[model samples]
Target: MSLQYVQGASLFTHINEVPKQYAYLTQNISTDVIIIGGGVTGSILGYYFSRQNIDCVLLEKSRIAFGSTSITTTLLQYELDSSLRDLEQYTPLENSLKAYKLGLKALDEIDAFINEQGNNCDYEKKDTLLYTSKKEEIAEVEEEYNLRKTHGFSAEFLTASSNPFSFDLKAGLYAMDGGAQLDPYKYTHQLLDVSSQKGLQVFENTEVVKVNYLDHGVEVETTYGYKVKGKIIIVATGYNTQLFTKRNFGVKTTTFNIATKPVTSFGGWPGRVLIRDNSSTYHYFRTTADNRILAGGEDISFVPGIFNEDAALEKYELLEARIKTMFPLIKDIEAEYKYCGAFASTQDNLGFLGKDPKNDKLWYCLGYGANGILFAILGGMMLSKLYLGTFDENLKLFKLDRFDG
Candidate 1:
């Protein structure tokens, strides 16, 4: 019945349809930290803090990982599809480089955690391909290639390959060391389990309705009329950020994805790395260990919470049509499920990470373009350090006030 509140179907949902730990909130409680969303970002924050012997509470309005986390194509690459050159323009070169380095570190930490926990989340290293559709773009790719090279980040510039898509390429970059793929939901749930095991409290079906900042702490009121107080409050609610910050911060983009039956024997897929072309409205894909080809990214936009059911169905039909058009090798592909969630994008297409502008104890981590998973991990590390008064020089570059004029 709780699944009815979930808008989309994902592989993670199929695996963990029922909650292994089901405890509803009935009374108010106090904690050192309260994480407002139970997606990848919030879960990671909870896990990290709990490991440090910090008392943390995680609240989800709906079910965990039922939101944008489930909708991800699950590519864990440090090389952003958004041009690294463009990223350097909005933020300092050092900050951009730090973000990239932090992304790789986060992916490595996530893989290590999965292995230690022994959670079968289909984690693997994959090479990410970023090719161009126009010949002129080759020079731009080269510039990025050299830029990354200067920083000691590994990226290979390729003009030709016997890859599946035979589209003419001006140039492309493949980062074999930085890219990865995994089941988004399985990873989120694993973090949840680990956090809980470390004494982190989690309340499902609990939604925060209002937040009041106190002189010494913050008070949060939930839809179920339960109130919680915490020394620091972190909002990781993604598109639902308006609930915490009254001012709207970014554009809400709509992206579609589809998964096919397992292609267990596809020779072209090696550990099922991520593949993407430099189309204006581009598509990126990867294969799951189960052999399903997961493709996504016909990026569009719609007003949040008002997305038309009919329009969403039509969008999915178009995605399925595109998947069938692009990869014809698999004959058993089908669009098993589809839904749309909003991706918060700032003017610079970078995340807004750090403490709230008006409140020092209130923190926010969002607007990560489309690649929120890595940012979530980085955010957890940064926020955890801030709360614990332990500082990492690498994370200092992502402080929230970085964007303030």
Candidate 2:
């Protein structure tokens, strides 16, 4: 069954074997930390917290990795949704640099985890290119490349003459060791499966219906009438955080994705490096291990359309056309899977983490943007430390109220 937030079959979930489902919470329990979502972020938190020997319970209202996690494009990048020059208007250049560096660190963390846990998620690191085919967009792309170079980050600027791929390019930042991709669905289960062996209690199909704040801690109850008490509760429920607070963290929109059936040859997309266009509304392209071409973008306002099948089909068709336009040489260009789902973005293109500014007992691990999986990796490391009283100064970049006036 498709989730309310997702409108089509997820390429990752449909191809992978069914993951083991954990039993629902049927009895009252107390733990040091109660994680309120069981997607990638929550599962990652469970891995870190349990490895640290902290008592924690992870609750998922539905099956694990079956929400927005299923439909995610998962073209992991170190760059923000906004470029450095654009993000400076919202925060300092220095802070954005910190976030970017933290992103690399998060990538390293994922690399280490994959090394330690085995790479069953089709995880691979590839060079990334953020380019534009429009002549006017060259300056913005160069500015981003220069920013990275000035900060000692490795990147090569490519114009139409220096372009390496078959696709048209006005200019682009070709970054080596700059990006990666994974099957987020498999990664979530990989983490949860291992974390459960380390004393982390995981419950699926268990909805957290209500939460109560105590003087020294927080407690929550399930829809089936079971209580869970903890010193603190971390909200990893993604965009569905209205139950904890009414604050709008960022603007949510519907993004669509289309994955073609496995092709014999990938023309132009040499090395199968991940590629993203440098436009306000741009498409991203990546190749799967099984040799399928995936394209995602075509964003629209979240309201009304995320619920409309006709709108989703239109986006899917547009995305399919994009794939054919970009690589007409590929034979049998047929879309095997297409999906759309809701995602949010901030002005600075960062996710919220650490303590909730308004509540001491409640914390947030919401990773909302293009760098979501990367941000979630950062949260799993930083927030887990914050839970043990060691604060990472870099978390200031992800402050929940940083956008508030």
Error of 1 at 295 (Å): 1.4
Error of 1 at 394 (Å): 3.7
lDDT against the true structure, per candidate, is 0.73, 0.88
Would you estimate the TM-scores of all the predictions?
Answer: 0.90, 0.97
The residue ranges of model 2 lying beyond 4 angstroms of the native Cα positions read: 304-306
Which candidate tops TM-score?
2
Give lDDT: candidate 1, residue 389: 85
